[model samples]
Target: MQGNSEVLVIDDHMKRKQQVELLLQFIGEPCKLVSSANIGEVLTEQVAWRAVVVGQVDIGSPFELVSQLAGQYKAQPFLLIGELGDCVADLPNVIGSVLEPFSHSQMTQMLHRCQDYHLKAPSKTKPTSQHQEILFRSLIGRSGGIQQVRQLIEQVAVTEANVLVLGDSGTGKEVVARNIHYMSARRSGPFVPVNCGAIPPDLLESELFGHEKGAFTGAISARKGRFEMAQGGTLFLDEIGDMPLNMQVKLLRVLQERCFERVGGSTSIDADVRIVAATHRNLEGMIDKGDFREDLFYRLNVFPIEMPSLSERREDVPLLMQELIERLASDHKVTIRLTERALDSLMEHTWPGNVRELANLVERLVILFPNGLIDVNDLPSKYRHVDAPEYDHEYDESLLEQDMLNDVFQNDVYEPPESSMSTQLPPEGLNLKEMMTELEIDMINQALETTDWVVSRAADLLGMRRTTLVEKMRKYSLSKDSA
Candidate 1:
């Protein structure tokens, strides 16, 4: 018998089971076939199976069949043998099923289909030895948007043009900024990071430009600011939109003349540093409202690079989670392995906080499920609603269809209600209207924040027809900030 060699023929009719087994044997996939009408009896078995030939009559209670199969062989692949509408589409572990009274060719085809499903199953795709080693370092991507970001980094890193990395918080803007600097001529120089929004206004001036002794109350000694210390290197200014107006003037001067001076010193020091600024704010909108300088906006925006959010690249979630799990395990000296179901749960979450949130969750899971196999039960109660499977935006039509079919055949026949259509798991108790309001507000704010309140780009972020998002913006009584 092949390693995964077991089959269950579920039907009330014993004769039908015999007929199907004979057909399966003729197809050269002979295996032990158990026929039972009672699902409880079938699932109670402690054996592993590759496929289940369920009859059309048995699909009304698909989970009984799924429960029987999945309970023991949840990881094992499934091929349903039944008529359309007969096999429940929501059954778990089912790869694909066929209509009943199958033909010889159909039996052979179903066998091949099951094999294909098994091959593509998550377990089979576990990272290779070399891949596992470099998984974390690979920048986690399985989507076109991310691929484009990586390509841009590779393309722009070789040039000396200043780059403005744009994205929401936790979207890896700094990572992209760093990659650009390292890939450029400044690789040998130190990469200094300064959070523009975090530093106080008065101090920020002296921090970036340095200060001569006796310049301010604490200026007991002359100190080299970030610009001088980062000379011949790259200076990453994070959250640049929050810099005070006066500071923006000095920054614009430095960018324009490529030279600046200490707060109290007259000597103009050469600012030989490459500027890579990023923000979760919309500088353009600030400029339009006269809060930011238009000239400064034009200067820093010479080469803009937008980072895609984790939701936009859901395909990479599993790979990224696995990578994070391994790294966390190694770091904390733990041996952690996720059950197939647990991994699925993690992938299903929307991750509004993006990669940073995912990383935190993985670390938490490690502490929670160390040594033991991390199964679906290990997942928090918020994730266990059977009706609401988690939704992943990154999944394509094929994967979604497959997931739907899997959900049909695997579960005990329950579906979530009153939640968003794309959601897979049950609700996390968020009120629908409130959630929509929040989502709308976030998208609008994020768009305005990123595009500097450029209506067209903000519209793009909301994914609504631009006009529609604008209408909603007016309808929802929302703004970047309240009056």
Candidate 2:
């Protein structure tokens, strides 16, 4: 084990040196090891004692003598011996000393200290109050919550297990997904995302597993799904809980087998993709109700990482706001600032929508206050008047208040035409029924616009929850297809 220098092992019993060397290597250390049978060898290799381990030097001279030798080297080396009584009194202050018959824990701790002695510079991002966003350009938080997330990201980046991200919509699940991909060993490869809930059940199969030409009426040519596209990279599944039960079974098989085949293709294809799935639903409850697959749950549950809600980490609000301000200013080519009062107003509100909602608010404020800084007055009337958005729909309030009623109870369901309405409303007026339909459409459109066309966000803006929004979308036959 000897190489360049000597780690003076002072003991008549040569077996002790072997014990120490074994301990050092077990702890992932690469050090030149040496053994000396006598004090004469200690003096010969005393210069090398700059990094020394004196074992059982407790019998003859006072402990101060070994201490003096350590002091001469400007490295007060410690002594590890079979018994304390073996040493003459007056041992100098050694880094650490322990009696022999030491437990594995005690030995390991000593080895760690030795490794710390040879410290090197850390080659990673530093801990700072201002955390970076997914782009690594924009800052995220000036508060404690975001900082904690950053810390967790650092801790988990090097692992090769699947990550399950749990957070409400618009809380930057995709942003977290990107960060994980970038931080992992596969950073150089692509990051492909599949919104499981957004796509139709029939198409979602092809969207994830690819499709051969002639597989379906619309399949004019062969196309790769998200898994194939993200080969040797990362495949992020957004809203994974929304996937059909059958698809979940197939997904579980792919995860277990790491292989799949395109629709209408006989040959199997390898899916060498790291998976990161996100969902807002209570998956455990879903699993209990037989809505989600148990095997798939276990497979994806390898590494469950629950993202902290925005309200839980309020300290980062200011930093996130500033970053949003700068980003919006750059994106739309407008300079905007937040007044102290406006900033205070932001801090005072509970962020149910999390970072995404805040970013939208900032963008809105920037657009609304182009001439100057935004004050409390510039904030939306909803935030000013109440924490929750006002529900102005024509549904019966009494029905909504009923204990047995569902989250959203639909009255008269209407499906829009295949051709979506224009981004601009129609100029031609219609009869009462058509007008009511048009007004409802207008409200949905406004919600989408105000929330930046994010369906879940639009739902929040419309004073309904995300699940309700999806249901309403089905009833009205609306889709992002128009966008």
> Whose lDDT is greatest here?
1
Report, for every candidate in turn, its global Cα lDDT versus the true structure.
0.65, 0.62
lDDT of 1 by residue, 190-287 (tens): 89999999998879999998999999898899999999989989999999989899999989999989999999999989988999999888888898
Which portions of model 2 miss their true places by more than 4 Å? 1-139, 142-144, 385-483
What residue pairs are clashing in model 2? 58-86, 142-319, 143-315, 143-316
Clashes of each: 27, 4
lDDT of 2 at 287: 89
What lDDT does candidate 1 reach at residue 450?
88
Give per-residue CA lDDT, model 2, range 1-483, as digits (tens). 111222444554456555555444322223444434245544532232323555644454435445555555432234455443334224342445545433323443453343333222122311111121134321254334455666666566668788888878777778878888876778778999989999999888899999999998989999999999999899999999999998998898899999999998988999899999999999999989999998888788787766777776554555466556555655677756554335545656787887778877877776677845555566786555223333333544333222111342224355455576444555884475876667788888788877777765686677665545544565677766774
Candidate 1, residue 44: Cα displacement in angstroms equals 58
TM-scores of all predicted structures: 0.53, 0.52
TM-score of predicted structure 2? 0.52
Q: Candidate 1 at 424: error in angstroms? A: 41
